[model samples]
Target: MQKLLYLLILIFFSTVAVAQDEDRELLRGTVLYLNSVVTGENVINANTRKATITNNAGQFEMLVKKGDTLVFSAVNYKFKSVVVTQDILDKRRMVVEVKEKVTELDEVVVTPESKERFLELEKEKYKKYDYERDQYTRLQNYATNSGTFYNGINFVNIFNALRGKKKKDQRNNEPLKVSQFLREMYEDEFFVVDLGIPQEDIGKFLFFCDDKIKPADIAGENREFKLLEFLVDQSIAYKKIPKE
Candidate 1:
């Protein structure tokens, strides 16, 4: 609902209303009860059905002619109406008012989306991003009750790697894109400080992180917290790798 300031019928005149149509002209207006501007209210002309909304400044412009009725409506505001008259047409600009209903926003429920679903969504959004070489990277996931989750090959990812046809579709830029996207989401501190993955080894560490879970799977989604959780847990397993 818009803010309410019980206002007297305010009739003001500015430059003549701009009538673009043979019969209609442009009418500028403001929706404010006091001196403060109201936001998010729709102002509509009932006769012509032309519409505009009160912006941050509570100002709007719409096409209008004499005898057209202007209606103001919003989620929290009581309906207010005014009619365009000859005097209003001469003025071109006017200020009006709306009364607010004492109410609150409706409740919203939030739930986490499945990682696979997020992956599918990102794939659709970045469909232009070619994923090349199903033959290149083998992947496996092993569930765990404690310590770091280890991805063990049980055969599925092996088949993926063996699929020769998948190689033809692989985009050469996907690996680079994956790294770039990760770098963009995470600051250097996340790699060097939080994960204890050195700046020099960050690139290799991301390669290691791709074994079980790839950030590319959910690239567009703003689920950085989920990525953070995965990275923290994955670093433990990464550290276990013997330094060459």
Candidate 2:
């Protein structure tokens, strides 16, 4: 009888162990936009390890075991990762909030005429400086023309030539400097737009500019002109107010 009781006790302990393991299993909560709508819906499941898209509102609920890692990702937003904790597991539901991404604009402008002139001068400078022989010429030229140029034709010409030569050399020889060389290494990347033109007229310019200009060109021109118009409109609106 004692042996029989011992066997039963062992069986009972085994069952309890299995139950504990099952309870400790991980769960995941995914947040996605439902039906492409911004309203979020969470799909909750504990037994399976899988990724589920959130509803349109970007909310999801899943059952996860302690120590399981949950990854949150969506288009245009930064990706995030969180490890499940005891507090999270204890909760009946978890709420994940995603913030909208904001893209900042650079205030500098680059005009088509200036771009052409800059490139032309850049080519001339490359030949003059012997950039093909001296690799450091490009880096040096970029450092010299790192800011806006509003006045003095001689300075602009000299600066642009050096910048162009350096940029060409870097593109041919070095791969790491390409992004910086394109963005900050040359002054030709930016153009200034003439703001005296009317906003209605600007639309016409865009249509004409399309054949000759790329998206980057449009953005540079539009951003500068829009900023100018916005400022002018604000000024005019304020002038109409009676002195207080």
Candidate 3:
């Protein structure tokens, strides 16, 4: 009878301790932009400072507790914070919508001369910068000068060439800078796991994508989605190439 009493006492204490413990649970959620998945965004627990990033499907999971504050942050998206509550904990899944930081101007007036000049610049790019070499000469010249870019123009790779090296060196290495930018932008798993390019072949696959379309062509514009789409297509093409 004493042993039975002691066992029940232990069980009661264990239940009390469990009931008093903090309600920490894994919360799963998707981030959406234009109703499409927004990958690579950050999900942070403001309380614990633990964090995780969204995957390709915009899904993310992180340990959150009741009353914990969750922070959502990413480039080109507005910063957001949410307070964890009983309902959120019970549901354990959420959908977060992030508003793009880009602002739409209500009205803009364009002068005829400016419009003509823009069109003229568009036409001049083909003749101005040699397309076959991907404008090596222009890039070399721009080593000390930040060149101008216009719409519908390709091969204006100012995003790369971070440091102004000597003209000869810049000319030789400027083209590879686009691939470098891409490499720095994403983790290796993006190429291997997400894109399905083999771990050893990431460099080769990036080069293949660069050759198809200069990933840096759309400078000063939101390029994440386009870059992801392009890489997906290129990865498909890359897998088809016969290996030695």
Pitting candidate 1 against candidate 2, the one with the higher TM-score is 1
What ranking of all candidate models by lDDT puts the best one first?
A: 3, 1, 2
lDDT tens readout by residue for model 2, 1-244 = 9999999999998897677557764443434321233343323233344456675455455546776666665554445666778887776455555443445464323322344443444345444644323432234433333443221122233345544666776556532221232222223212112222334443343333333323232122223333223323433333355655
Error of 2 at 37 (Å): 9.4
What lDDT tens digits, residue by residue, belong to model 3 across residues 1-244? 9999999999998886565444578889999986789999999988777789999999999878889999999987899998988898899998899988755564332222234443334345435644434422333333423444433222234454533333547446444455655664556765665566778999987777666775445354444345545666667678889999
* Per-residue accuracy of model 1 over 108-218 as CA lDDT, tens digit each: 221112334433443353334322322111232322223322121122222233343346667642333334445534556657755667788898877776666654454
State the weakest 10-residue window (summed lDDT) of model 1. 8-17
Give the least accurate 10-residue stretch of model 2, judged by summed lDDT.
Answer: 186-195
lDDT of each: 0.59, 0.43, 0.66
C-alpha TM-score for every candidate = 0.34, 0.27, 0.36
The prediction achieving the highest lDDT against the true structure is 3
